[model samples]
Target: MRLADVVLPDSAVCSAAVDVAETYASPALLNHSFRSYTWAAAYGTAQGLAFDPELLFVAALLHDIGLVAEFDSHTVPFEVAGGSVAWVFAAGAGWSRDRRRRVSEVVVRHMGTEVDPAQDPEGFLLARATGVDITGRNVDDFPAGFRAEVLQRYPRLGLVEEFVRCFEDQAKRKPDSSAAAAIGNDLAARMARNPLERPE
Candidate 1:
């Protein structure tokens, strides 16, 4: 689906989320976050699943906020740190307690291997989209033309190399965190072969 055709919620909450994420994350990281949202939205549409656009948008944009140095919690996994930040953002926007909790859950669980959409649709889609963007996993489910369309709107801008560096930095700082565990299992080889890191 085209970025324009994709309907995002328009409100103070959504706008504030964009502002906060853009302020904290690097440009490459911001673009990745936006792409993750679009990919997840597309997947939801294809699967005939209903999702809360506002929550999904907020969760996706801020999923990696903890990777930003200012938000990092030295002892926690980056996802947990990011989730904490998201909870505050959502709460400040007057989200109900349950809504804010879902926001936190979605951000914290995005790195999981599998999540049931029926139970946690936001987390499930966020993980799936992030996986597709970061590792090119399940990318074939999206038509080549549409994938190109999305990329044109939000280019990777060397996101693969940038994100790998961010993950590596986090892992080194918190060796027992999930980021450290993903290094050899989920990230290492894919980052080495990532197309975004290829010479132009």
Candidate 2:
């Protein structure tokens, strides 16, 4: 499904974020990123921490919004690129410092699995919500601290299982793997270039 289909409408908080994020991110990249984040949110919901699906989803969508303002080289680090976007979006949204900090942390640690439990709880939660095992394989490889935090903070949104199952079914109908790999590589390279950090 498309971003409009997956994103919730009730919360203006996240909807606004999506609007800003999509305005800057390439259409293809936005679509792919949204799908990935949606899948993760579904997984998290299924695992029992029922976070505000819209909140998490919006955060994921705009995680890289900084790229738009920081568009310099093509190899900008993800954390730096994403940080720029978070700073701008948070400022525009008038979010508190804590909220901005949380968004920044999520953007930086979303890809890597080596999250520090205490220092990066939001990052840890995003990882859990996205279903990436810290060990990079078995779901059981997730750290106890991360898992416990998710359970405590997010509870269960009740729609995650359905979302995950639907995503699984959709993945089965995809085309050749090579094309997917190529697309992923291209996107990664583009993201690395710091697209979100461009001056507005």
Candidate 3:
């Protein structure tokens, strides 16, 4: 399925998620959040995966929220803090406790190495989509025309620089966090060479 064929969910919670993302996220990050959903939705549709659009949309919009200064955690990892933020947002949205927990789990899982789609399709989709957006992994999975469409709708701005800087700050503050581990693994260098930024 093509990204253009997917309809963005417009539930009340979905609207609130966009507002929150725009309020706290940088221009680059805000667009990243929107693009992430588009990527995941398109991927899921193409794979014939069964997933909840609302849940995935909310999770994608708020997944990197902890990277923002407004919500950055001093002790826990950014993804951990972001998960809490999602939990609170879900609570305020009147989602059931289980669904709230699911959102939180999805946020944290987005940072993990891998997730099985059968167990958690939203988490799997979010992880893959974020990888594509941030690291340009699996870019060829989407047709070139569709990738251009997504980039046109939600421009990258300076997401690579801005996101790497955020993770650097997070690593310094939370040495044991995932950001720290990623730094040690040369995440910045890899992201610098991302194909999305130097497409030929």
lDDT of 1 by residue, 5-114 (tens): 67777888989999998888998999999989999998998888888889999999999999998998888999999999999998899999999999999999998888
Model 3 lDDT, residue 18, Cα? 91
lDDT of each: 0.86, 0.48, 0.91
For each of the candidates, the C-alpha root-mean-square deviation to the true structure, in angstroms, is 2.0, 13.6, 1.1
Q: Which wins on TM-score, candidate 1 or candidate 3?
A: 3
After best superposition, candidate 2 residue 34: deviation in angstroms?
Answer: 1.6
What candidate 1 gets wrong by more than 4 Å, as runs, is 192-200
Of candidate 1, the 10-residue stretch with the lowest lDDT total is: 191-200
Q: Can you give the lDDT of residue 99 in candidate 2?
A: 74
Clashing pairs in 3: none
Return the TM-score for each candidate structure.
0.94, 0.53, 0.97
User: What residue pairs clash in candidate 1, if any at all?
Assistant: none
- For residues 41-140, could you state the per-residue lDDT of candidate 2 as single tens digits? 5454445644545435656776545334344223445444665677567767787787776776677676565766456544655665343311122334
TM-score of the candidate numbered 1? 0.94
